[model samples]
Target: MSIWEMLAVFAAGISAGTINTIVGSGTLITFPVLLATGLPPVTATVSNALGLIPGSISGAIGYRKELEGQRPRVLKLTVGALVGGLTGATLLLALPSTAFETIVPVLVALALLLVILQPRISKAVQSRRARTGTPAHPDGGPLLFIGLTLASVYGGYFTAAQGIIYLSLMGMLVDDTMQRLNAVKNVLAAIVNSIAALFFLFVADFDWTAVVLIAVGSALGGQIGAKVGRRLSPAFLRALIVTVGTAAIVQLVLR
Candidate 1:
């Protein structure tokens, strides 16, 4: 790759890491940039997954405070993430590249809607629970587990907008502050990426240079993103998620 292209990928990595930490869909930034550099689609996807591991971990660490007392939830959800990630990674290798193309935008759009309506939805659920005299489950119950597992499968395949989906599900079901849900989102993202990367290491092709460049860049960006993300008001953060998610849908359609 040319020095200019290399710089561009590195820059995209930083931006992706920051955005992934704050909301999700960091892949939208880095994936196209990698493609512009002439990497094959599958190669770029695998390489990006590997490269972003550091960033995911970094972001999770940055949100460590918010992660407090969420151990049972994290641990339980991780089982689902691992299984879904493995399945998705396998499908990525086995299926044609375009297999998921038609449905991905629709899924992301739905996730965006959920994020937008989460407050009202949560309120309604809470009111219903009050009427029924039902106690809220600390770990978001089985439905959240199932929903997140399904989302993780997509994340394992193509990570763009995965965080948005996760936050949408967790925000509705978990009954926590958005920031705390985001914290869990980061951890789950880290797990899904890590597991997928591990799977790719054995069975997929990767551009080591791209991986190294993104790894370094995203790691730096993760810290930056966490710092900035923690400060935003929930309303502003929700707005940002909508904006980024809309852009992701447009980019996917154009692609």
Candidate 2:
């Protein structure tokens, strides 16, 4: 790749890492840039998944304080992430590239919609619970496990706005502060990425250069995300993500 393309990928990695740490959906940033660099869809997905692993780990570590006393929760949810991630990775390899190409645009669009509507959804969920005077299941019950498992499968496959989905589900099912749920989100994301990437190593093709560039950059961004992301304006971040995601859709559809 040219120096310019390399730089672009690195920059996207930083952005994605930061975003993934804070809100999830960092893939939306890197995936398009990878495509712009001429990598095929499946290859880009695999590389992105592999590259973001470090970022996810870094973010989880940064949130260590919030993770206190959440071991049982983490352990239980981990099973789902592991199972779902493997399932999704298998699907990616089993499906034809043509199917992935067709389905991804639709998935990206849906993910963007979820990102856009996330706040309202959270508020609505909270309101419903309050109205019913229902208490949240300490372990998020079967529903959260199922929801997170499904989201992890999606993450393992495409690595898009799965974080947003994670937060949304946790928000609805678990009665915890956003920060704590976000901490768990990072852990789950790391697991899904790690598992899928490991699977890719055996059966999938990827661009090593893309993976390295994104890995280093995203790792740095994860630290920055943990330290600075909370201070940044939520609205601004959402707007930037939506803008980039829209461009990605255009690029994918045109190609």
Candidate 3:
């Protein structure tokens, strides 16, 4: 890639990392940026997955405190996440774009709706949970493996706003603090991207220079984002999702 492409990817990585750290829709930022650079849609998607792995890791680590007391939960759910992510990455590698093209926008729109309603949904969950007088541990955390697995699969494949899906699912099916749930979400998200990145490095096209720059930018952004994440209002991220997501959809449709 050219120097300009390197710069854009790096910038996108930082933005994505920060957003991931704060709100969990970082891919919605970088994926389109890569597409604008003339990469094929799936290629851009995979390359963006590779570039964002480090950022996801950094964000996961930054939220480690929230992961406490979740070992059993993580253990049970991570298997599904890992396996499903591998499958998702393989699907991306094996299938051509035609298979996913029609479905991609639908997924993005779902993510947008999830982000848009996250606050109200989360609040309502908390309120209902408070009145329920028991952890939603019915059938032991709801056996949400299928949902988690599917979510991870999506993350590995496209990963636009996988966090919103994660947040929404955990809110519904799992009995955990929102903070802890979000921590799990970040870790699992990284796992998906990490698996996809591994597959891409050995089997798919990549631009290592751009990946390096993006990783560095993402590293710094993750730290900064995690440090002051709580300061931002939901309105800010919602505005971002609407503006950026709408723009991305428009560009894709126009293309």
Candidate 4:
């Protein structure tokens, strides 16, 4: 790769890291950047997945305060994400692109709709809980399992706005402040991306220049995302992510 290409990847990494930390949609940034640099679709997807692992890990670590008391829960739930991510990645490699293409638009649209409804739904759920005088959890085990499993499956497959899916699920199924759940989201997302990245690094062809550049920049941007997260209201960020995710879905649909 030329110096310019390496720089472009590094820039993409920074953009992805910040986007992932703040709003979720790091894939929307890095994936296209790599594709523009001439990687095949699958290769770009896999390589970006690997490179963005650090950003996820970084964001999780940055939220250590929120994670301080949630270790056991995180461990239990992380397995679902791990399994789902591997399943998704393997499917990506093994299944024909034609099959994936047919399914992705539907998934993306559904995911975006979830993103769009997050605020209103969360408020309504909270209001219902308050009126019922119930403790934080109203749904219990089956709901928790289903929600995590769904998030994991989505994370494993394609994590454009996986945060929205997780935030909505965790908000409904678990009782925690949005900030605290955000920490859990980072950890689960990290496990999904990090594991897939490790697999790709060992098995797939990658542009190492792109990987290194993105990894470094994303790591830095991730730290900043965590630092700034609470200061900024997430309403606008969610709106932007949904907008971009919708655009990406539209592009895919056209293709």
lDDT of 3: 0.73
Regions more than 4 Å wrong, model 3? 108-135, 138-143, 232-255
Candidate 1 — worst ten consecutive residues by lDDT sum?
96-105
Q: What is the C-alpha local distance difference test score of each model?
A: 0.95, 0.84, 0.73, 0.75
Tell me the tens digit of each residue's lDDT in model 1 across 1-255.
Answer: 999999999999999999999999999999999999999999999999999999999999999999999999999999999998888899899999999877899999999999999999999999999999999999999999999999999999998899999999998898899999999999999999999999999999999999999999999999999999999999999999999999999999999
- Candidate 3 lDDT over 1-255, as tens digits, reads 778877888898998888787657677677777777787777777778887888888888888887777878888878878887888888887877667655656766766676576667756866887998745563125446888888788777777667766766665565455566767877888888888788888888876666777788788777776666644444664565456666555644555
Ranking by lDDT: 1, 2, 4, 3
The candidate scoring highest on lDDT is 1
Runs off by more than 4 Å, candidate 4: 123-134, 138-140, 234-244, 247-255
Off by over 4 Å in 2: 98-135, 232-255
Rank ordering of all candidates by TM-score, starting from the highest: 1, 4, 2, 3
Alpha-carbon RMSD to native, per candidate? 0.6, 3.2, 3.4, 2.6
- lDDT string, candidate 4, 1-255, tens digits: 677877888888987887677657777778777888899887887778878888998988888888877887787788778887887777777777576567766776776776677677777877897999866643225676667766666666667667766765666566666677778888888998987777777777777777778889889888988898755556665666577677767776775
Model 1 root-mean-square deviation: 0.6
- Alpha-carbon TM-score of each model against the true structure: 0.99, 0.83, 0.81, 0.86
Model 4 steric clash pairs:
85-156
Better candidate by lDDT, 1 or 3: 1
- Report the alpha-carbon TM-score of model 4 versus the true structure: 0.86
Best by TM-score: 1
Q: Write the per-residue lDDT of candidate 2 for residues 135-250, one digit (tens) a residue.
A: 76787999989988988887788877677678767765677776787789899999999999999999999999999999999999999888875554656656655665676677
